[model samples]
Structure formats: C-alpha cells, structure tokens
Target: MSNLPKTMKALVAYGPGDYRLETEHPVPVCGPDDIIIKTEGCGVCVSDVKCYHGAGRYWGSETEKAWVEPPFIPGHEFLGFVAEIGENVKGFEIGDRITADQILPCGECRFCKSGRYWMCQPHKMFGYQNTNDGGMAEYVRYPKTAVISRVPKELPREKALLIEPYACSKHAVDRAGVTNEDILVIAGAGTLGLGMITYARMKNPAKLVVVDMIDERLEKAKDFGADIVINPSKEDAIAKIMELTDGYGCDIYIEATGHPSSVKQGLAMVRKLGTFVEFGVFAQETSVDWSVIGDGKELNVLGSHISPYCYPFVIEHMTDGSLKTDGLIKRTFPIEKWEEAFEYASGKYGDFKVAITFD
Candidate 1:
C-alpha cells in the first residue's frame, strides 16, 4: 500500500572475523520470480561461526567461498512474513508467514534430478559462504524455490525459528535410518545434537544416549529425552556408549559436533555394521580413522547437507506437537543487536541457540 525504504539495518560481516550492526544497507531487490520477506526471527547456526571464522574451509567449494562474501548479512535459519511477492509468484501472498530452506538446488542439475539436491552441481546456499545476504536483517530476498513452508499460526516465532535446524536434524535421523529397535547415540549435545536427541525420541528408539563434555548441554539432552547422558570430561565416552549398548555398540550414531576427534569417536562407537551420519561441519584436513571404516565392518557413512525432502515431514511433526521446540531455543535478540546475538551464539555468551528477532 506504500513505498518501501531503500536502506535497512543488517548484521554485516565485513570480511571474516565477526559481525557488526549496520544500518546503511539497501533493501534487497527482487526478480520477477523472487519474493522479499520481512524477517521476523533468525536463528544463529554453528555454520555461521564456521563461515565467519574460516571453519568452513573444509567444504572446498568456490560457490560457498563466494557466497560467504565479505560485508554481507549472515543468518540462514529464520522465519519471516512475506513483505512483497513478485508477479507470477503463486500460492503465496504478501503478509503470509514463512521460513526458508537456506540450501537451494538447481532443479535441472543431475544431482537434483536424482533427489540429492544437497549435492547439486550448482548448489546455492543461503546466509552461508556463497549465495546471497541472509535474514539477519530487516528483509531478505529469495527465489520462490527457497521458501520451505508457511509458519503455523499456533507456533510462536521463537519456536518457529527452530524449523531450519530441526529440518537438518530430521535429515540426519532419516539418514541414520533410526528405528524403534535401534540404539541411537548422538555425539555432542549442542543445539543440533539436542534436536537430534529430541527428534530421535519421537522414533521411540529402544535406547538413546547423548554424549557431551559440558554438563549443561548434557542436562539439556536429558530434558530432550536422552535415556543416558555421558560427560566425556569425567569418563570414557566410547566405553560408556559401549556399555550402554551392552558391548554391542550403538546401531546408529549421529555426529553433530564438528570436532574431528568426536567424528572419529562416533565412528568407533557404532556397531560393526551400524550407520554413522555426520551432521557437523569439520575443519579442513581433519583426518578420520578410515582404516577401521574400510576394514569391512559394513559401516554406512552418511553426509547430510541440510534437508532436501525432510522439511514437510519436520513441519508436520512440529505442527502435530511431535517435535518440541521449547527449551532448545535459548534467547532472542533484536536484529539491531546482531553482533551481540552472534557473540552469544558463538559460545561467548553461553551454550544456546541465540536468535535475532525483527519485531
């Protein structure tokens, strides 16, 4: 009904060190097939840390590197209201609430056609190392394909903020092939690990053990329904996992911590033929015990990049009250205070998922 302003506030990353609260940014321009969203909430993901702190070097992709551009906005996990929908856009209207998938694939790519859009030859990521400015601002511009789903009216913005990360955890669980009979072990009780624990509980696993070095996170894991919580700092985690599995080892292991040692240990804690799904991003050149993996242990190693077809399922479960977003969300910050938000999310403030809210 009125003309929008040209400049807007954003949390901009100049190069790589940290984020700054910037107010002099042009609102993103949209193409005929694109939509502009007025950001409502943006979750601070660990990948934001990797991108800004150079921990994403392991990805080895020029697109990613280019996407994580200097002097850019940074927040992929977010929900927003459709501010303006370009002509030709269908099924969505201005003022509609929605969240983004973050990782967009070229539908024409062979990998995408094969249903492995995460591995698309020309992959496009949001608020990462190489795509476009993210939602840590007043507005975010996106293509129609990037929109995952509309937010439920019953879901709080804070709870809706968990959608992206939840989608990721869902993908990891799906890859692990979690079943009621499987003994699920999640490495790292961080946000992703915690979500994995919570979502894993929905599958009614026979046993669920979450491992973390920090007591607070372990407690959070417990709150999320982990049957057993292990503190590696005080005890042997691998042995504890083995004991929990009755010396048989866990049937499925999900690695949500980026530490290489944890990855190697996750591999070790799996049953002889168990599946190991990696949900964390390890730094460049991080080595693993491939020898054991290649020793014909029948190990299945899966690398999940966000979620391809898991969004709808996550939304359904969340809408049906199967996946709980409470407790997992720590706090919220106004978009103007994005620096403080990023700092809090980077573990400087505390262990929690710090989200930036527009309103």
Candidate 2:
C-alpha cells in the first residue's frame, strides 16, 4: 500500500466551464469495503458536454433544483485496472480489469430492494456527486454498494470503455420490443443511437433506419447495421421514413439525439399504435404536444434511463467480436490534453468519439 503514490492528476469541477486539472490531487484510499482502480481510460460522453455547459438537468433550473452535486469529477463512461482491493472485497484481485454501472443504488432503497436499482430513489450517479468521484481522475474508488462487473481481457481497452454506453443502448433497444416484422427508425447517429442500431439489428427488424444531420455519422451508421440513413438537413427525415414504410411510418422510433427537433420528428415518423422510446439527455426542455400520442396514434411512449442489467449481455458480444467499433472512438488524447479531448468530443473536430487516457 505504501508503494502507491499519495497524489495524482485529476479534473475537478467547480461550475459551468470551470473544470480544472489538478496535478497534485490526492490519490483515493481503499476503504475496508471498497476498492481503488488506476483508471486506464475514460470516454467523453455528450452528457459530460451538457454538464460542462451547465444544462438545466446537470445544473439547476429555476423550477427544478440541480441534479448534479457540483465540484465532482464528471466522466461516467470509464473503466480501469484494479490497483488495490479491500480486504472485504471478494472475487477481485489487484490486476483485474473491471468497471461498474454509473448508478450507485443504496441497496436498501425500495427500488434497489425490489431489483429495479436503476431507478434508485437517491439517484446517486457517479461523476455527479462528491460521494462518488468518477474516472476523470488518475484513480477512482468503487464503494462497497457498487454493482461491479469484469471486463474481459480479450477486448481492447477502447472497446471495453464502451461497456457503459452500450449497456444503456442495449436496454433502450430492449424497451422498443422490436420484432422481425417491424420497421425501426432510430433518431441520431451518435454513440447511443449507433448502439441502438447495433442491438436493434440483432432483433432482425424489417428495416433499420437512422436519422442524423451529419453525413459522417450516417456513413458509420451503415457499418453499425442501419439499413438506410437519412440526413434531415438535406431531405425530410419523417417523409423519408414514411416512404420507406409505405406511408405507414416506422413501427418503432427511438430518439437518441438530445436535439429538440429529433423529438418532434420521431412523433411524426412513428406509425399509430407504434412503440416510441426516448433515451436522449437534452440540454434544454423539449416541449412536444401529447395530443398526437393519445387521440391520434395511441403510441406506447417509453422512457429509458441508465443501463440496468445489460452489462453481461453486452460484454459477451464485445468479447466475441460480434459488435463493430470501426469509426466509433476514432479519437483519443492523453490526460494532459483533456481540454482538447473535450472540445473534440463536443463536435469541434468532427471526431466520432473522444476518450482521455491515463497511464
């Protein structure tokens, strides 16, 4: 234990646009029921960007209080190698690669007690609160209550870092309940949308369509299993989906883009009595009329939060090479260049994905 460094580099948050990189941040100590990891890498997700910009969800709105606990490290899409294990920790060793779901249920909460821990009342997500410092630092501690899982050594660290997002993506697809006879249209070509495409393709939907404004993302969506890609900036996306479905509209529409337009477009592109899943994290409120949902379509509108029990299923596919990761994660930066990494992820450099690495 004395061999570990006392202090390390970390990105600490104070407020909007106030993330500071500290070189002498104290390295966390392992509690009796907790373990510490030497972070290998952490993915820069759009949620991190939204938080950086002080989105009402992360920061607070006048009506609804803030969700973020502020002044906490904020990278949830992350993984690392276990450097120190608590004496009470079982089934884990010092050199094992592992990761945990972002949601840290209190174990005694009603939802956690009933096995629906993803909706834990406290909603103590990592990277948001001080109690759970995220992987934005050189080292991170996993609490005794954390739901941990092993990342197979067979998968590359880059791909392994995707376990968290892919887990959420898999859960969204599962919510859609797609069938071979259904036409599924996913809005957005970002990581989560593409992830939805990957898992939805496995469901063998009649036609898997992706809608996005970016040409580059649409191109990669093809490789990820989108049967057709529509760029809304050029052509009418809702009209295109209707045309592909013979004017009936897609049987299922999943919104993964945080943009407000994606919400309205999905409502119009989904057929009557269709299933619509909303999985995006919007920086602003997306106000849409519900009349079309009740009086006109009677659609099954569903909301998906963080990943629940999909880690194992996603890990198996990732290890077996069934999942594709070509254009995704096309960019990386050393922790020293985290500012650039964040800017690149905010679509400044047109990179598909951005990750900050640690040694």
Candidate 3:
C-alpha cells in the first residue's frame, strides 16, 4: 500500500461520445474481502464500442433499465496482476496473474445456489452495472462477490486478454452439442466466432462452415478449423449452406454475429430439430416471424449468456495450446491513445480485436 500510487490514469464513461481519460483518477481502495489489481491490459469489446457510440440497447428506453450506469469504467475483457489482497482474502498471492468472469454472481441467488452462477438472478455484470467498476483503468478493484480466477503466467498476453470472450464462446459451442455427423454453421469470423470454431473443431463436426463479409476473416476461419468458408457479400450464404447440406439444412447453427440479419439467416439455415445457439449481443431488438421457430422449423433455439464454469477449461487449454489464437488481436495502444485504439477497433483497422495496454 505504501509503494502504490495515490492517483492513476483512468478511462471514465459519462455518456455517448463522452469517455474521458482522467489523469488523476483516485486508486480504488481494497475492502476486507475485495481485491485490487494493476491492470495490464483490457480488450475493447463490440458492446463497449456500441455503448460509446450511443447504441440504443445500452442507453435504454422507458421500458428497460439502462444497461450502462455511466460515470463508470467500461471494460470486461481484461487481465491484471494482483497488486493488493484484502486482509480477509485467500487463495491469491501479491503478484499472481489473474482475470475474472465478466459476471459477479450473488452467492445466494437461485442460479448461484444451483451451480448455474452465470445466470445469477441479479445479473450484475462487470463494465455494465454501477456496482462493478470495470478494468478500463490503470488499477481496478474486484468486489467481494467477484468470481475471480488465476490466469496461467505462461499464457501469452494475446490469449490472456481474450479469456473472457473465449470463455463465452466456449459456452456457446458447448450448447450446440455438435456431433461428428452434424454439419455446423458458425456465422461471423471475428473474435467470438473464431473461438467457437476452435472449440467446435474439438467436437469433430463433419463439416464446419463459416460465414462472414471479410475475406481475410474467412481465410482465418479456415486456418482455425473450418472445413468451408462462406462470404455472404460475394454469394448467397444461406443458399450455399442449403446446397452443402443437400437441402436438409445444417444440423447446428451458432449465431455469433451481432447483426439482426444473422438471426434471420440462422433460422433459415438450420434444419428441423437442429440446435440454434444465439450468443451475440445486438444493438437493438431483432424481429422475425414467430412461426419459423415453432411451426415452420420446430428448431431447438438456445440462448447463451456470459461464460460460467469455463475459466478453468479456457486457462488449461490456452496454456496447453489446444485453443489457437495466433494473430487474433490485431493492434494495441497505450492507455493515453484509447480514442485511436477504439477507432481502429471499430473496423477501420480490420475486423480483428484491438486492446489498450497499461504500463
């Protein structure tokens, strides 16, 4: 405590287009059961970008509570080193590398009591709620209720930075329940979709088809484990999928693209009784014909939220090199250049991931 700085640089969100980098933000204090860490880096997520640019879902309407409680930090995909452990905290050291689940579940909730903590009734998420101060700053505080996990020091910065998204992606892939006989379609080849490809590959699906607009991401999809890649910008992706499956439709469709079109597209590309996993966050509500899900296709539509019971698997496979993330993160900038980093992240510098690094 004596050696740590009193004030540190931080990125604070006020409203859309009003995020400021404050040079004198006070260091977060550690409570008896809380943990404080020196943030090494934090990845900019699509939701973060959407919120910064005034997405309606984050802003909220008269109907729903605001997803973003402003005047707070806004980063969930982050990695840090334990700088200060609370007096009552255990199972962590002063210098342990660590990351946490995006969710901070209340232990007494029905979901938490049933071991499905990710779906905790309170639904408190880091970077969104007022209670959780996210890691878009030099130093971040993890509350007493945070579900923290130690990251393997041997893991590369690129992979460690992706643990949160990768964990959610793994959860979506697991929900798909792909089999060797199943033909799987994973739409979107960005950060989350690529993680789905890596994990879906382990399932040994017969043919893994990837759909995206960018040719480069489609190429990267092939490298990850896709048996075939589809560029909807160049051709009719849904029709091509139909032909591939001999008009029977794919056995599993995982929608990782946040676009509303992807939801409708998955509904058309999957066969009756096939599994449909929806994991992406959309900026607005998606409307579709109700019959397509029940009467028309009778599809098994499943929705996946943030990762639960997956950090251990992610850390182990990432350390063993089973989950590949070579060349996933495209660029990084110092905390001072956050605006530039986010601009490049919003597709100016390709559709890959961009991160903000802290010294």
Candidate 4:
C-alpha cells in the first residue's frame, strides 16, 4: 500500500462530446465497504460511442432525462486486479482478478426488494456518475453493494474483458427462449451481437443466422459458429431471410444493430408469433408500425437492458472455452493513446472490440 500513488490518470467526461484525459486525477480512497482495483483493461461499448456523439438518450432529449452526469470517468466493461481492499470487505484479497456488475442497486428500492434489482429506481452505474467513477483509468472503486465476481487467472485479459458484454447478450438470448428447434437470427455482428451468437449457438438452435454490412464481421460470425452469414449491404436481407426460412421468416430475431432501420427490418422479417429481442441502444427514436406487433403479426417483442444476474453464467462459459474469444479484441491502446483508441472504436473500422490497457 505504501507504493500506491496519490493520484492516477483518468478519462473524465465533462458533457456531451466533451471528454478530457486528466493525468492527475485523485486515486479513489477505499472506504470501509469499498475496494480499489488496478484496471487491467477496459472495453469500449456502443453506449460510449453514443455518449461521445452527444446522443440524446445519454445526454438528454425533449422527452427523456439524461442518464449521464458529467465530470466522471467513462468505462463500464472492464476487468482488473484488486489493489486495495477495504477493512470491512470480505471474500476478496489483494491482487485478485475481478470485474463488477456495473449497476449498483439501491437495496431499499421497491424493485430491489422484489429481487428485480436491475430495475431499481435509483440505481447508479459505475461509468456514468461521479459517485461511481468508472474503469477508464489506472484504477476504479468498487462499492460495497456492487455485484462482483473473481476472474480465473487462466483467462486472458481480452477474454476476461468480454464477460460483461456477454452477460448482456446471454440475458437477451434467455429472454428470447431459444430452443434446438428454433431458427435464430442475430441482426448485427458487433461485439454484443457476436456475443449473442456465441451463447445462442450453445443452445444448439436448428439454424443461427448473422447479419452485418461488413464482410469481415460476417466471416468472423461464421467462424464463431453462425450457420449462415448475410451481408445486408449487398444482398436483399428481407428477401434472403424469407427464402432461407421458406417464406415463414425467422422464429426468433435478436436486434443488436443500433440503426433504427434494423428495428423495422426485424418487424418485417419475424414470422407471426415469433419472438423479437431488442438489445441495442439507439441514438434517437425509431418509428415503427404498432399494428405489426399487435394485429398484423402478433409478435413477441422484448427489451434487453444491461447485464443483470447473468454475470456468473458468462464467466463460467468463458472459463470453460465455450465462449470463443479469439480475435474478438482486435486492438488495444495504452492510456496515453485514448483519443486514438476512442476514434478507432467509434469508427468501427472493421473491428470487433477495442480496449484500453494499462501497463
């Protein structure tokens, strides 16, 4: 503990489209019930991109209040080693590899009392508010109430970093209720989309289809066990899906593309009584036909939020190699190159996931 520095470098978000890499930010103190972590790596998420572009869902829109308050570090998907353990904390030792559930639920909330903590009214996420400084830095503080799990030492940093996103995808797949007889279509091949494919494949679905505009991602999806890969930019996606499903369309559609058009496409491609799981964070509102969900198709639409109780399942899968991680993390950058890393992540540039690593 004597060797620990008083301050560390951190990426602070001041407001929409405003972020600064501060070299001398205070190293968070470990409260009696908190633990400090030395960040190993942090993955960039699509929400981070939306926040960077000043999307109203994160910043603020006329109808919705903003989720992010400024002057806080901005990273949620990360893994690291325990740096300082609090006096009252138990079951964790110094140097233990760990990653936490980003959402900190207020146990007193009604939803929390009902065991639905994911819907806690006053929940705080690690990366969005000052109270819980995020992992885009040399260190981060894990609150007493934060749900944390230890990572196996055998797991590579790149794969460990995927646990969070994979938990989210797992929850979406679970919600979709996929079975061996079901034909599943994942509407994107990005990190989360690919994560969905990884977990959905485990269900041994009759067929797993992946759709993406990028050929590289489509190929990667095929390598990741996708039975079919579609390049929507070149092929007529609706027509191809109909032909593949023999005009019945897909039994389940998982929408991971944030583009509004994907929502409409899912509505059009899913068969009557089919299930649709919406897992993307959009920049703006999408207009779709309400009748298609009710009278026209009677489809079952589900919304997937952040990782809730599925962290352990994801970690277990990653530990056993059931979840493929090779080539998922395409690039890594040191904290000094945050701007470059952020631009590369935002551009997508034919990459799956980008990470910021600490020395």
Q: Tell me each candidate's TM-score.
A: 0.91, 0.97, 0.96, 0.96
Off by over 4 Å in 4: 1-3
lDDT of 2 by residue, 1-359 (tens): 53579999999988988999999988888888998999999999888887897888778888778988867888988898898888898999888988999998999989999999999999998899978889899999999989888988778888987888899999999998999999998998888887888888889998999989999899989999989999988998888887788898899989998789999999998999999999987767788899999998999999999899999888889888777665678778887888888899888777767898887
Kindly list the per-residue Cα lDDT of model 1 for residues 241-337, writing each as its tens digit: 8877789788988888888888888877898988988888766547876877778577888887787677777777787877866776767888766
lDDT of 4 by residue, 1-359 (tens): 43468999999999987899999999998888988999999988767877877888778888879888788899999889999988899899889999988798888889888988887898789899988888899999998888898889898888998998899989999999999999899999888888889899899999999988888888888988899998877989889889988999999999998889999989999999999999887766899989999999999999988878999888988989998878988799998888778888875576678989998
Which residue pairs in candidate 4 have backbone atoms (N, alpha carbon, C) closer than 3 angstroms, thus clashing? none
lDDT of 1 at 230: 85
Model 3 stretches with alpha carbons more than 4 Å out: none
**Lowest summed-lDDT stretch of 10 residues in model 3?**
56-65
lDDT agreement with native, every candidate: 0.78, 0.88, 0.88, 0.88
True lDDT of residue 8, candidate 1: 90
Model 4 — TM-score against the truth? 0.96
Task: Flag the better candidate by TM-score, 1 or 2.
Answer: 2
Positional deviation of residue 111's Cα in model 3 after best superposition, in angstroms: 1.8
Model 4 worst lDDT window (10 residues) = 343-352
